[model samples]
Target: MESQVTNNANALRLFFTDDVFVVEDKSVQIVLPAVTEAVSATVSIPKVEAKEAVVVVENTVIPAEKPLPPSESYAQKGEILPIVEEPLQPKAFKFLGGNKKSVLILVNDAAYDVSTEQGRELLRKIVKAVDLATPDFALLNYANYKGTTYAELHQFFKPQIMLSFGVEASHLQLNLNWAGEIIVHETTRIIFAPNLHPLDSDLSAKKSLWGNLQKIK
Candidate 1:
């Protein structure tokens, strides 16, 4: 009789005989009796670590409301605004009279006040002496005269002749278009004293004065 045994990491085989017994490695060949038995070894497997879990969250926000704009106001009734007017300035008058041209004689001096009635009379006498029918004359005295009154005199009689007698350094202003035959007599001739008109016939005398004044160049 014969016997044999074999062992492996996972399994083992064994046999028995009357005469002899033998032992061999797992991969080696072995002869065994018909009553042999095989045994399988149990194996243990390790568990793997669980995978990590993931979480998802969703959030939403809403904004606050804003205020609206205010409405416009209505205008009030019965409000009156004042009108503005500009002040008037003085202006010289131009010549408008035809062949019957007028004359203006001015004696600009500090020694005489032509604005006064006495001074005007003296100047009228002097102008009359130039000719018995000498043109109408007016003397503007700036020394004693106001600017408003002088402007008024310019407005009243638009003369054609302007004479500055005994004038020092002051300038006599007259309308250039209306004034003609400007004469400057510095002498104290007072020849005009005899040419005085009747106090009652001032208008007729003025007419005669303008007629004679037209004869001047």
Candidate 2:
């Protein structure tokens, strides 16, 4: 019986051979041997847990477009034309030889030519005659002949009634006629004649001749 007890003690020493042993309460205890050096040991472990998954959602908005006007479309077509008007003609007057009663004499003595001197003198005489015969006559010298300087002699004169000799009647006729109370003379007529008819009466329908001769006188 003592031998069996020794055998049991040896078996227990083998089973608890390590320096530490685990107990039923999950705690550990270290054992030291009496006749040998003590041994040590350390143990490590990890814990794990279960989890669930998740999802997410969202929403958004957009804007609408607008239409253009009809007039803007027509403007882009490019087919319309603009209207224009004709210019009116200037009124004509007797610029040279006419009735002494309504005559306007313009003497151009500015000409350097010697031949024009006699013409200038003759113009002076005609101007004097017109002034004496009709108080309504207008006499302008070379200094006063403004507007068209290089225009035709008649255009330069612009007379209501022109009493002239030689080139004067010819120049007057170039731009005007006997229509507007004109009495042209190639040669000086000693006897003067007056038109009994009123000056506003349409003597010629060729040109647009209107306006009262009373205004001119």
Best by TM-score: 1
lDDT of 2 by residue, 81-168 (tens): 5556554334343332433454444443334321154444543443453344434454443323334221333343344454322223
TM-score of 1: 0.25
lDDT (0 to 1) per candidate: 0.41, 0.37
lDDT tens readout by residue for model 1, 84-104: 775445554332123133444
**lDDT score of residue 186 within candidate 1:** 33
Residue-level error in angstroms, candidate 2, position 71? 6.5
Off by over 4 Å in 1: 1-101, 111-125, 132-135, 146-156, 167-217
lDDT of 1 at 104: 44
